[model samples]
Target: MSAIALRGPERVVIHQHRRALWSAGALALMGVAVVVAAWLWASSASDTFAGSGCSVENTVRGCGDTVRAFLDTELRFSRAVDYAGLAMMVLPACVGMFVAGPLVGRELESGTYQTSWSQSVSPARWLAARLAVPAVLTLAGVSVLSAFSAWAWSRAKGTYYPRGDWYEREVYGAMGTAPVGYALCVLALGALAGLLLRRTVAAMVVTVLAYVPLVMVLNRVREDLWPTARFLGGDRPGGDAWPVDSGMLTASGRAIRLKDCSGGAGDTAACMRDRGGVTAFADYHPASHFWPLQLVETGILLALAALAVALAFRVLRRRHG
Candidate 1:
């Protein structure tokens, strides 16, 4: 097969990792089953309350048992959805560790990569195939999980459980392309780490260490990626909005944090009036900002992934050639 087609290397990589691939597929299917079952359970439980005319907000004397049952089921479903989101959040780290340790690092550590290189498979081709196969599999799996997560979030959101906001850290990562971007980025980073360290355990540890801080920094700055809407005076964003900043506005229109003004005798309003504060203000990203933020973060991660892939290939060529 031609190098451009990558058919030969692709086959070799797939065959080598077939066991791991099957295991990953089984896990993905199990996740789908869990999500489906949880949704069904919640929906069925909801029927009891629906027929009784008792919602979470409106509970009558005779509807106690029905409400309790509905709440129990809804809480379970909510926990399932949350756990799924947490899994999606953790998947990139798992992918990175696997790519670093078993995929690339183990071969290089054991000198097996040389065998592949000697068999007319150039170093570049070998690395590309290694990256491509896992990338495709990870993408497919994450996309499927993300779709279901989004579905689950939509179904139970804004109901009794108010924990599934789109902007929330776990929900945000699981429901959109951001998780895919993060996985791809970590995958490339793992390959690069493996190439640079040339040790399975070392590369895995480094990938995890590097990824943790990267995610932390991204989460810290995520709200600033897009411009926030400003609301002055009595106007405020809806409950679903992600509040970025809130403070009191001075008479001259300068924004000062509420914490800066000390409440005299515990009277915050009196303190605010004494400090030239005219009105309260808030800055937030409404629900419409979800797509824009997701796109921006995903774009940044993709660029980083491309950079990591280039670095990995460059390192491989420099050392081998």
Candidate 2:
């Protein structure tokens, strides 16, 4: 019985993908955990941000700033997930990568591609169904997580890049739904690697090596295009600079000051004001570069996915011959 309508072995590949469904569910659960943590964080930090704990004794940055602009506002869904949502949005990629790698690569390693190779369906159709079904699931899971993140971040957009701490935007902007795109790209790479190496574990290793660089490059590429943020010493504490993207300065031309330590406020303490740069330089305005960077980042990831698909088809054609 010659059939190309995904009747026989193609269903098996799709089922293999489905067998990994628990990982996707776990990703969804992780999203819930992120939301809960955000609620707890906002609740506890609300009082502190609202002028309750403006002291040199506090360990948190901007503690003495006496700024609660966002805190005064109610916590809404948009604000809760927007920036913090990146954590959830990105979690699925890890799940998707590990899941995608084994779906067909394992079969190929076991010489199952041969069974399908002997069929009328062709390697192309086999790969297509295998990649498409799970990628769709990955996308759906990501969509939910991103929606939550966007809504949450929107609520507290004011806190996107709070003063003296530019890490928020860096984290949220670079780390958000961007990972979803990376996951799809990784899946494509997995399909290609599974096709080429024909070994599940080896293909996974290749996928990891290939995808990690792409992911890291995706983030750095965002910074590079935006003329704004950049990696600060490989995601660790050290000598690396991330240019601050404090929105455009007020029309009043009033310079926002970076305060200095008088040493009397304690060695670990700092007092900042919106006055001038007598103490230090004010944050750079990243407003101009933000979206440009985002677009660049998104484009790069999609490009990687496209390249993988293109190569997958090419390799499948070769295998067909």
Maximum-TM-score candidate: 1
Q: Give stretches of model 1 more than 4 Å off.
A: 1-6, 52-65, 262-275
**Which clashing pairs does model 1 show?**
none
Task: Give Cα-based local distance difference scores for all models.
Answer: 0.86, 0.56
* Model 1: lDDT of residue 75: 86
| Model 2 alpha-carbon drift over 4 Å, by segment | 1-11, 37-96, 117-119, 151-170, 173-177, 227-289
Q: What is the lDDT of candidate 2?
A: 0.56
Worst 10 residues of 1 by lDDT: 1-10
Error of 1 at 27 (Å): 0.6
lDDT tens digits by residue: candidate 1, 1-321: 223455688888887877887897788788878877977988888776788887667777788888889888888888888888888899999899889999999999999988888899998888989899889888888888888889888877844774557888988989788999999999999999999999999999999998998899899999999999988876678768998877778879887766665553677655766778789898999999998999999999999999999999889879987
Evaluated at residue 283, the lDDT of candidate 1 is: 91
